[model samples]
Target: MDIVLASKRRRFVWSVAAAITAVAAGDVLFYQRGAYGGQTGFALAALLLLAIACRPAIWRDRRAWVAAAAAFAFALQMVRDPGPLPWTLYWVAAGMTVLLPATGTFDDGWRWFQRLLAHALRSVVAPVLDLVRWRRVRRARSQWRFNLSDGLRGVALPIIGSGVILLLFVAANPVLAQWVDRLAGPGLWELDAVRIMIWIVLLVAAWSLLHPRPIQPIMGTFDGSGELPLPGVTVASVRRSLIAFNLLFAVQNGLDIAYLSGSVPMPAGITLADYAHRGAYPLIATALLAALFVLVTLRPGSHTAAIPAIRRLVGLWIGQNLILVASSMLRTIDYVEAYSLTGLRLAALAWMALVGCGLVFILWRLRGGRSASWLINANLAAAGLVVSSFALTDSAAFVASWNARHAADVGGRGAALDLCYLRMLGDSSLPALIELEQRPDIAPALRDRVRYVRNAVLFTLDRRMHDGGWTWHGERRLAAARAEFPDLPARLPMPAGDRMCDGRLKPPPAPPAPESSPLTVAARP
Candidate 1:
């Protein structure tokens, strides 16, 4: 009975400590005054929240410790990149890490999915359960009088002690001081609907981790075998489909090799860019459909997969699909060369690559006679890896830098520098804009235009740095820009309308039509 009471006391103490840490850290790291945020603050808050939320597993299980560390590192990657991709990767990695003990293993994608749903359910249910537990505790302790003064008296030691320890730690580590400075940068008292929403979300996410349950996954990994009761798909149907698909894909590949080769003349009125760009995304969709058909019809252990001839046909079809994917990638690249790359185009390129990888995994699964679980896990792992890789690199900054370098303004032969688009990219384009503004090759008139855009971006970044949603990378860039160009404006330019931000007075002139000649084409790359 004494032991049970001690255990309850420990649980209550830990819960209080974790809750206090979460609230204080969240306010310091995640509170945004205005519209923009979720870069640096999110990176820090995610890790801190993971620690506090997963504290139970973290202390008891080695696997949990490893998962927490991995999540922390993954989330920390956003410090450098800080875009939508990183944000997604961080949440996925963090969520899975928090739920790892409950799921038992990471090998089954279906089980993880089941656990994800449970995680959401727990986010809503756990807090109510906690309140019930607290009520019971309060009833048990009712004999001892408690009030607001008693609560203040109880917390004083912890508050003063923690402050002293934190000061010493900061003194020992200069980096901690930097973190504190950044955390203290935003307003401390701001509150609104959005911030309240953020608070609710943070609380729910944290509490879900704190009160985890070992859920028996309801959905098991499905192996797409003949015995699974799939209907209407037969060996004969798959064989015929493969034959027709092979023939159709062959025709498409043939046209790509001939017309896209630049060695052979394209049809009248169809230019290289038109042919290349037109089929870029559509071909990817076609490949996806072909991949789905192969997965659904020629599933491993199915009669369609047993025959060597059909397997060969499937292999041939998959190879053709890969070629189609490659052609689509080439087409997108060619379009990028002719036009320019944007964040969306870059993501499209990544998506195409992911499609190609998925097709390869599908073919591998069939060849190995692997289960549906294997195929699903392999594809998901491939996708997660691709997203993680992209997350580690700042795609927006890369796009901005690439566009600026290749823009026709500095004589790189690509599209003219679109100041409007650059402005839309926000502070990610600030460094590139700064570089373009200082380039010796820029025309005097173009230099003035670049200066205006650069100033506008600089001003906005300053507001973010002071207000909220700023990154360490952004801070470094701002510092470097100040050192390089003292004349860079921190105030909004007096010029309004077209010259305000990106300064688009009129639409940019349409680019000239592409030549039909293969020699001028960049399709090969």
Candidate 2:
């Protein structure tokens, strides 16, 4: 049995070595290239290497195929657009793929999450320790051995003496020193801290990929018939709590309907801006907390969840939460209208929509008696779809265009034009700036600044287009913007002011009306 275990350990070592070599080679050949080709090659190489290392185990497991597909999808996304969101999704998907074969069927999302965390921790530590133990055993079984300590002791004095002699020679003879300097190239022995750190990280990542530890799924026979030990969580108490919560939410909703719906005048000293800004974020927080409470109190298979009255109350509460989410959205819209629209406000609106969807999903789960895992997966899918859509959409361009059209100078309801903000939007705002420049009513000062900004953006876009830095979407947008201003000059005149909006300069006042001629009046008489 000991020999058999040793044999298995040896085979594992060989497999790890092979995988490491393959990964290192692949990194050198493919990962050293640019993002698109590099990511594509690395994904293919990684999947192939994993297949070779895991062999029949990976080949037979259906989960392995799923993991491979996910990896491919991640690579495709990176090739399309490499950013934080796509990378985050790739890491999560890759982590799950590494643990999928080891974990058993989980009964709940919590348990599955717990096992995944454990598996990640174990994968980091187990492989290296096991390799160390195997090496120790192999050393014990060797027929002959040389002590590394004794060998180092034999060479230490000579090495020290040689270093001292070299220093003495360099100090005594300038020519020798000069010769030494000439022979020793600059940075030959110098360490690059960044490169060293990167290599170390890569090595560790490769090690983890090669020897992932298995996670044993929790399969305890203890049925979930036991009740939670909360003393005040009886059905009646939950019902009362839900009723109070509903009434409190109703009051807030009523105020929203009165003020936000434009049906009644706002009270004195309370502006619409104040009303919108104060409640948008806090209401979203309240909805989140309410969702958490419902999940905990009315957990599946719980006694509180079994009561029909409590269930009805929970559904009603969820419905109220949904209304609150809508009101929060309206508040955000109102705020954007009063102020100016920004990326954060747009994100807030999207987040509110997601929250509303989550509330609806929760009510559906409760009605249908779905598992926790189901709810978790459903929400994850929803979030992933939203994020993926956002990744493809150029949000900066949308914000820039909206702001441009709504600026006060353009006969729109928004505040004074923010050329600085538009400039910060980079190439995405070029089209809007061009459109602003073409308007006849635009002040000369503002138009000059707009032309300056547009030219700067166009220069950047032109350079990126020439240098292959611009993506297809960027190129397309630039082409469209250029088409709008067909007669734009090749060069723009510089603006006189440093500030975005010079407060000192105002629009020229209308010329005084000319007095009527006296001769013409006498002729009329």
Q: Find the candidate with the highest TM-score and give its number.
A: 1
* Candidate 1 C-alpha error for residue 31, in Å: 5.8
For model 2, the run of ten residues with the poorest summed lDDT: 29-38
Model 1 residue 461 CA deviation (Å) reads: 0.3
Q: TM-score of model 1 relative to the true fold? A: 0.79
Candidate 2: residue 212 Cα off by (Å): 2.3
Which pairs of residues clash in candidate 1, taking residues 3 or more apart in a chain or in different chains? 498-503
lDDT of each: 0.74, 0.69
TM of each candidate vs. truth: 0.79, 0.68
Q: Lowest-scoring 10 consecutive residues by lDDT in candidate 1? A: 32-41
Candidate 1 stretches with Cα past 4 Å from truth are 1-9, 28-56, 59-62, 78-84, 133-202, 227-232, 489-501, 504-525
Clashing pairs in 2: none
lDDT of 2 by residue, 1-525 (tens): 667765566557566765566555544433432223224435544644564355445656687667656656765555544556656655555656666666565355455566666666665566567667756765775642433345569999999999899989988999998887676533334456744554455555555555566665565322322256577777888889999999999999999999998899999999898999999999999999998887777777788888898898898899999999999999988888776788788988999999998888888877777766677767767777787667656677788888888878777787777777887777768767877888898888778778777776777666655543534545566677668867755543344444333223446678999998777445565
Judged by lDDT, which candidate is best?
A: 1
lDDT of 1 by residue, 29-79 (tens): 566444245455453555456455535555666666665665666566665
